[model samples]
Target chain A: MEKAEILGPAGNLSSLKAAVDAGADVVYLGFNDSTNARNFEGLNFTEDDLREGIEYLRGKGKKFYLAINTFPQASNFKDWENSVDKAVTLGADALILANTGVLKYASEKYPTTRLHLSVQASASNYEAINFYKKHFNIKRVILPRVLTTGEIRTISENTDVELEAFILGGLCINIEGRCYLSSYVTGASTNTEGACSPSRFVDFSPTDGGGMTISLNKITLNRLSAGEKSPYPTCCKGRYLTSDGELSYAMEEPESLNALSLIPDLIEAGVSALKIEGRQRTKSYVGTVTGILREAVDSYYVNPASFAVKKEWTEKTRETFEGTSSTLGSYAGK
Target chain B: MRDKMELTLGPILFEWERSEVLDFYKAALTLPVDTVYIGEVVCVKKRSLTIKDIETIGKDLEQAGKKVVLSTLAIVSNEEELELVRELSKLGFSIEANDASALKIAKDAGRTIFAGPHIKTYNKHDAFFLESIGVKNICLPVELPKESIKDIAQNTNLKYEVFAFGKIPLAFSWRCYTERTYGLSKSECAWHCKDHPEGIDLRADTKENGKKAAPIFTINGTSILSGKNLSLLEFTEDLRDTKVDALRISPQYKDTGEVIKIFRDKINGKINYKDSSERLQALIKKPLTNGYYNDKAGMEFLEINDILNV
Candidate 1:
């Protein structure tokens, strides 16, 4: 079997270099516009910055993928169309798209540029996966973090397109790109606006008891005890009073998903790429996770029969997340 | 075109008893709703209604000269569910694909389809693609503003539907929030969602002191819906003028029949926008919002607040 490609998030220029230098075979980045999922400030590349990043990746013999995955609103779809055109001009290896209009336009205008279905499209089964492969002729699909490894294996067996599974980082409590929770709370959405719990709508207040409360759009979402690292106020992870009036994390815990131990299993399931989910993290995190994943994949390919996750591999990445705990998530949840 | 706008009752989102489910449809038989979307669209585990049961209901509804649409799950992640969607498509009714996977099966089987909101038909290209396929109608996503809905509704020859009432479905996930809230797994969830027939309320405080406020969201199995139901009773004129074929009312746990009557009156011009909007509030006991119909935050009533940093 061919060695699985290790993909990393390229939030900015330094992060792009961090991912490439740390041995990422492919790096996915979004433009400065709010057309992609990680609509954060100072996080994505300007058009010029994207060109520079592509040049850098080409110099290192690596691949570049542009994610223009947000659904364009009806009144102003020109921006999304323009972004797809720019990505094709930059010679991106593939375009990770979610919108129907954007995907159709890209396939027709830039016939040579390959297209990869974004996880935001929420194509979880062979039928949906193959629909894109047949209609848009999608070369790859980034599976939403909702399927078990067995289900992944089954879909891979049924569909011809390459499968990319998320191996590390934050998990969307709701299925990718289908969620309206953030927009309900703060008027930002992963599907339409390419943002979830955007920082600009967040406000932190110090309580009289020395605890801090994080609110989105003047609504208290989560409260942290003193000295605790206050996480982003994503609505799904927020602690709220349940039906019986118990204050708890009613929707989901603020835990990131870690699937490192499933590397060999995923590879055997015919998944061609392993993607890390953080496109909003700093360069240190982008670099370290990319480096660790690179080592793990390389070592697995060297000795596939006796592959195992090393103790050092777990230790080196322990503090990368806030909770220091990870979940196998739907991979095992099913 | 008909003298009145078509009224569609969306899928039953809550897990009611089998008897209650049957009774809801029987009562709906008399309501002014033209189309009733039957079948499971929320979680696969909700056993209140089965494909066989929906087929039975479809037969009765069809005999009564009403339209039936079998709605598919919003997040279809496995093969067994795909098998179910495939089977449902051939049940002698139009298929409403809440998931894109559902669309594929319906298309392959040569069935007429209604592209639900989860399919994300945002532009003319999406509309054209669905038209090329067997899809005859596309339900616009709930968050679209009046201008955006008009942009497509007027431009495309395809029929369109708008979510006119009920708690707006916000998101869906693999892990059931109703089960997870009680420290139960999805498989072992024990149907805790049935206890909150309307859904467990979620409140986000307006002040920093962590004070109590009205519920802002509701947790029902894997589905998260708005705390308050969305009522577009006031927008009937504009919707009809724009040639929207249907006004979808998501099935609520209570007063669904009453809500349907209110919209029906509004559509026929028997009631003015202000009078009907006020009557809708009396039927459903929660705050109402039309912010999404206007270009503003979804939960806000009129988006009177400043666009703080957004």
Candidate 2:
């Protein structure tokens, strides 16, 4: 059996180099536009930046994947097509796409180009996975963070495509590519604009009790007491009052997904690659996470039965996370 | 301009008792709707109405001179859900493919498919792609603006349906919020969502100094919906001009029959836009919004005159 690959996120040339230097087998990034899911301003790469980043990865004998995952607008489908053409021209190892139209264009125009389905596609079951494989010849699929390890094993047994599972990073409570809450409150479509809880609509005001309240589009998402850290005002992680007059985190709390202890189970479930989320994070995050996960994967390969998570690794990864806590997410079977 | 448009009743998104489910469809047989979508589209754990029950309902609706389409789950994460979709495809009724997995299963079985809103048909290319795969009709995504809908309708020959009324579905998650709120695990949820057939209203105190609570969203099991009902009755003229073939009304817990009657009257020009809009507002307790149709924040309530002037 082949060793699983450690895929890391890189927003710029510096992060790309950091990930590569820290022993990431593959680094994924996106162009600086709404064509990608993490379409935040001042993040992502320009054409010049892509050239440098790709060069850096090739020098280190590592691979890089280009993410063109957002659904293209009817008025400007050419923008997505142009990105596909550019990615192939720039020698991307694979194209991570979410929309069927974009997948059709990439497959027909560049038949030999390797295609991988992005998690944003939300293709969770084997039938959906096989559909993409049959149509576009997708080589791998980044599984959505909704399935348990047992379910992953069942899907792997049923489909012939390689599976890439998220092992670390911010967790999306809602299924990817299907959420419209951000657009509901802010008028910025996460599907088209590629941003959720966009920064322009976010406001933080100090209260009389010395605490702060975070609002998205002037709609309060949460009220933090004094010394309590506030998570990003994404609609899902917000605390709201239910019909029963109780205020609580109705969707999900602010917690990152850490699957360090489940690495062996994931490997046994036939996951070929382990992906770490957060391309919008800093370079140090990319470096530290990649290094720790790299050691974990290596240790598992060395001695499968005796492999165990180190306390230092969990502590280091937790320090770089968005929230103070971490969860096994759906991988633990509800 | 198109003079006639069909009225479609979307599948029940909330959990209801089996008897209540049958009673609703039995009453739907007498409504003015032209087509009725029946199935569990939100969570697979919902087993109030079995496939056998849906088949029985589909037959009765068909005999009553209404087209019936079986809707699939919006999220297919496991083999159990996939098997359910596969079984649904085998039934003789036309299947409404909510997820790509259902789309594949139904298309492969040679079933006529209506691409549901969750399929993400944002561009003409997406519509064309689904059309090429034998999809005959498409329900546009909830967040698309009027202009984009016009562009797609102009480019594709497929029948287009817009979500014209009811609470807009916002997001779906694996963790059941209904179970989470009750401090129960998903496996042992005990069907608590049945307690709130209309969904649990999620509100927040947006005002800094006021004690008023503003409704934010509606938690329905694993899915979240916009707190306000989306009523496009005032824009019937505009939608007619956009060349939409159908308008969909998602089933609410109560007053759905009255809501359907008002929309039918407006479509037939018996009641004017303002009168129909006023009646709908008075009928439902929740507020109404049309911001998504006007290309603004979906939670905003845009006036009809303001939309027309723009």
On residues B116-191, what C-alpha lDDT tens digit does candidate 1 reach at each position? 9888887777898888777899998888878778888888898899998989999988889888877888879798
lDDT of 2 by residue, B172-193 (tens): 8888988999998677778999
Which digits, one per residue and each the tens of the lDDT, describe model 1 over residues A209-298? 888988888778888888766346688778888757788878777787778899988888889999998889989999998999999999
Model 2: lDDT to the true structure: 0.90
Q: Ten-residue segment with the worst summed lDDT in candidate 2 chain A?
A: A228-237
Instruction: List clash counts for every candidate, in order.
Output: 0, 0
What's the CA error at residue B48 for candidate 1, in Å? 1.2
Give candidate 1's total backbone clashes. 0
